[model samples]
Target: MDGSIKVKNLTKTYKGDVKAVQGVSFEVEEGEFFAFLGPNGAGKSTTVQILTTLVKPTEGEIFVGGINVKDNPEGVRRNIGVALQETGIDSVLTGRELIEMQARLFGFSKKEAKTRAVELLELVDLTGDADRPSGKYSGGMRRRLDLAMTLVHNPKVLFLDEPTTGLDPMNRKAIWKEIKRLNREEGTTIFLTTQYLEEADQLADRISIINQGRIVAEGSAEELKRTLGFDAIQLTFETTEEAEQASKVLYGIGENMEHSKEEVTIYTENGTQFLPELVRNLDEQHLSPKTINVKPPSLDDVFINVTNEEKERV
Candidate 1:
């Protein structure tokens, strides 16, 4: 099986001929944590479904672990573990039973299945709850069990679509830790999809932002943010008149700089260079900037900018 998961010219169309995914292409490297981020209707799930062979693409070339997905989806399934957003667990089964069953279904011997089940429960920190009925488990525990089930085959690649979505803050952090451990210790490749920007920023080695069925941006968080330069300087004023006066002084710093209410925001290339001059100019204008803050563009900002630009073109 090839280590990399590659997709070329992928597209998905519904019955009404509405395109869900359009010509999306990317590569997930061997043993890398890659994230696909977008809003609810942005084709993220459609792409995952196509790649994992749950749904066929209208047009595309997909290779998972070097096996042609279209030709041998079962082979691709054998090599990949998928923990979808929806948990597929039997409430009647005990946690241990669930894991054991998954292992057995993957062709593990009885003894090996039990041992692997124990190991997985321990790794996911659900060992203490192994004897409990799955119906009694919490949302987070259920999610962990779902992931454990997916790993019964020790798949090389894991597809996690919003694994932490409904969990509380603590549970979310706990799941994040387990994900990191799985990647670092077992060297598993993970393809993640999430609506949370911070999750993508924190976990992904590289991020691809999708919108309106197309990839609008792709890069490391820092690299994409750097492209926007250091913009948006915030300033406080002693008085409304003073703020208004300061706004006029640094008007040229941005394409459409503005001073609204109490703060003056200017988009500039070199914030530091512009700061000193801005202060001096404000002083000349008989105004004082009580607080100054310069924030570089963030992934959220980039998402908004790029998507807005796309909307304008239409």
Candidate 2:
């Protein structure tokens, strides 16, 4: 538990009566990959800022690596590394110079700083371009350089806020691979925040979804999806009339139903078990669909369900 984080009743309120985070509580075990997920303006950034000591919480407490954030902000900072959404590296500096400077700022000797710089360049797969000015680097390369700079201190915990936000799919996957490797090989604790459902599903050992300054759900990706305990079967018809007609016959078989102009989605405990009956019911109603698809519950479904429920309560 050396690199663990403990948060209790954390709250942050900005000026103009804005409440960014409200009574949030969670824990991240040592060496764990934890994801904080939400839409824009959901307070994920505010929470990360609080945890990283950039912002003070209005209520409650947070401890990083056994150090109270408010009591010993420097201690908390010393043990953690942060790579924010924005690439803050100087455009004039080469990748090697940036990392070496970061290491030197962390108290490494000149020789040690150079050694750490080379090691990090290799770790981030930027060795070939280590001497190139960062201003000329692509978006993905700049992100990699930022990550390397964050690790120059060999911190026990890492905070990545939307680390792959603007990258293409190929670059996003490459960054994901590097993050996974670091967590696995270095045993570093990771706290990540992102809007991408696929990124959380792929990277987090556990996830917490925040909405309107509150945590609506927290669990493993599979666990959250399983909580729905149903599969979805989507049927696409020629028109809304046919879909509405089919819905009437298929009403009682599923727990929930959603219909669009030309499609109807049914959520049931077992889609395969209900498929034949659904088809027969539609046939009897003289309704035909253009396509049918069944899929297991996914993280997107969990997010939609939780956030929608929260919205209804508000």
Candidate 3:
């Protein structure tokens, strides 16, 4: 690809007639933190595997760092570092040893490899434990070591697949901080694949959501939330009938104006304006809601709304 990455018309199919990716296309710019997000079995791993040259796409043109992966996969491999969802670090090997091996695989001299190993251990906050066998490290420490190994090759681009899958909140935060620092200080373009929306929101400059082997949404976190409107208002009443009446008053403003046993939830563009109008209508109908809450739309809401829209069309 002339750019950092370019994939066009990508498709992947497994046995039993299952299509994993369907005509997926996207371009990642240099030094960008791009996230691939999706529910389980949404073809995320398939796409990553193709881009990293682990699996060939059934049909597509994939280029990484200006090299066509299908044609010059070796070139692509030389320019990219991949930390897969599965950690392949040798349990018996010390963190320093694994990093040294990775550096030499990329053709580093023995002295240069040793120097880089120490640097990466410090970069990933593993300097103190660099001599410990990977089997004795915590989950977060192992992940950091994996990342250090990936960076030992000094790739222009780094691929991280669910890098913080099973870590405590504190450890997850620590990893997130280092990821941002890597992108900022080293100018390493990151292709992060994660299931957690919050992780993408925090780290990705742009995010693409794939579902059912197709892209459902793509944008920055704020832009995706904007597509779902500005606010979500919850109105709770004393009875279901009162909630139903409120829905009629707010019908045109919200589509999924759901009414449960005693509450109604509505989507609106400007909840501040809509709430007053809703209150007036409810009073005229002899209904008074017991509670009203207005909150900004979130990425979770955007995912639910966009995915539901896709399902209905199917």
Candidate 4:
């Protein structure tokens, strides 16, 4: 009740009786970095909108920063900072002007707004480009500027929706550094919704994956990976024919298996223990692999498996 976020039995239904979100419930401790991951149209956006007070829920209780969203939407908004994937950056305004305007919107005087702008520009490493029109800023630079705008009021909670969706790898890393700093140095609670699974795996203290309007899994990256409960043996053969053959031979030996044109990936418990038998089976079949790499289950595997299961059920 006194924490960053708490929701119970949250549901959202639209005009056509579309159940966008169904009985979703979760919590985020103050200062915790939480990630909400889902495929598109998995009710992720609708849930965030409700929490941020941009949309109303059809049923259930929702609270953010200790305020009930339905009862005091304005109070909930005051304690939250939201930087969405499509958040606009006015092309005509300079970075400095934009940030100053945001500060003023929160009731800062001219002098205070200017000072706050200077501080934020420094915080996001945009001081050098503060005077340039935002239209000239790079994608990454614009993202940083947008993030700085969100923090103008120093809200207790920050919501970031795909903050690095289209940036090149180098720019994405830069944004990741800034976001990590917000959590570590400023002790800010971050609720992140990212298209990049690696970003969520690396940045969030805990992750919740929603599928088909319901939470299918939730945990730390490692914990979620463990949920799959198997190590992957990634075997690459000399040819597509060989790879297909390997899958046939390795069938029933693994908990599950998948293969492509030239790669056969077998998932099984105790990969090391299975290696000896795998080698023998390949030798017997006269199949020589180009590479055989063993790895623990990755976040990608967990996400795909969970969502794929949901699809199968539907």
* Residue lDDT tens for model 1, 237-282: 7778778878777777563365678877776677777778878877
lDDT of 1 at 162: 85
Give the C-alpha lDDT of model 1.
0.84
The sequence of per-residue lDDT tens digits that candidate 2 reaches over residues 91-206 is 99999999999998889999999999989999888999999999999999999899999998888999999999999998899889988987999899999999987798899999
Clashes of each: 3, 0, 1, 0
- TM-score, cand. 1 vs. native: 0.79
Each model's lDDT? 0.84, 0.88, 0.85, 0.87
Task: Answer with 2 or 3, whichever has the higher TM-score.
Answer: 2
lDDT of 3 by residue, 1-314 (tens): 22288889999988887999999999999999999988778888889999999998999898899898899889899888899997588999999999999999999999999999989998888999999899999888888898888877778988988888888998899889988988988888999998887899899999999887898899997787667655778889888887777777777776555567788877778788877777877788888889999887554555567876877899
- Candidate 4 residue pairs that clash: none
Q: RMSD of each candidate?
A: 4.6, 3.1, 3.6, 3.6
| Pairs in clash, predicted candidate 1 | 1-65, 2-65, 2-66
Clashing pairs for predicted structure model 2, backbone only: none
lDDT, model 1, position 15: 94
Q: Could you estimate the TM-score for every candidate? A: 0.79, 0.84, 0.82, 0.83
Give model 3's clash tally: 1
TM-score: model 4 vs. ground truth: 0.83
Name the TM-score of candidate 2: 0.84
Which predicted model would earn the best TM-score? 2
TM-score winner, 3 or 4: 4
Q: Can you tell me which runs of candidate 2 are displaced by over 4 Å?
A: 235-249, 259-263, 269-273, 286-298, 307-314
Residue 225's lDDT within candidate 2 is 60
